[model samples]
Structure formats: structure tokens, C-alpha cells
Target: MAKETKNFVLRLDAQTMEAIEKWAEDEFRSVNGQILYILCEALKKSKRLPKTKNEPTKSNT
Candidate 1:
């Protein structure tokens, strides 16, 4: 089955938006994709996102 995603509106300052746009371009990703990537990284760092069955653990390979 496909994963479900929730959508919400986000607001940011013009300067911050421009910085994100540049960072996204540098990383060869869309602005939205970059934001999602950053959020996912933060969640992982904080241990808020649990590992899924499909993901390989450090000892698996």
C-alpha cells in the first residue's frame, strides 16, 4: 500500500525562503522536496521516526 501524507500551509520570511531556494537548487531538488528532506532529517536525528521493516539495520549488511 502507498503511504499517506498530510498537507499543511507553511509561512516563511522572504530572506529565509530565498536561502532555502538556493540550498535546494544547489542540492538539485525542488523547494518542497528540500523542505521535506530537512524535516525528515531533523525527525530522524531526534529519534522521533522509527525505523521501518524494509530499512536495513547496521548489522544487516
Candidate 2:
């Protein structure tokens, strides 16, 4: 099966971009992939990702 992909444009400072590039190289992934992987992991860790259709409602005081 073929893998799906998407494109996006992200802005960062030169130093931060450089660091991400280096990390991507170390992990044998493209910079974009590394960034996505990191964000997915972070969201999973924080339990704020993969949102459901119905979010909880706030009580009206």
C-alpha cells in the first residue's frame, strides 16, 4: 500500500530550524516527519489529541 502525505508551511527561526534538521538526520526522518512525530507524541502524552466529535459543554452559571 502507498503511504498518504500532506503538505504544510511552518515558520521558525534559523537556529530552531537548524536544530530540527539535525534531529531529523539523527532519527533518519525528514524534518517534516520529525516535527509531526514529535507533535503527535506530545498531544498523546498530554491527552489533548485525537479529539472526539462531541466536546464536553461548560455549565452556564
Candidate 1 lDDT over 1-61, as tens digits, reads 9989899999999999999999999999999999999999999999898999997889996
Task: Compute the lDDT for candidate 1.
Answer: 0.96
Pairs of residues at least 3 apart in sequence or in different chains that clash in candidate 1: none
| TM-score of candidate 1 versus the correct structure, residues matched by position | 0.81
User: lDDT value for candidate 2?
Assistant: 0.86
Question: Considering every candidate listed, which one attains the maximal TM-score?
Answer: 1
Residue 61 CA error for candidate 1 (Å)? Answer: 9.8
In model 1, the worst 10-residue window by lDDT is 52-61
The CA root-mean-square deviation of candidate 2, after full C-alpha superposition on the true structure, stands at: 6.9
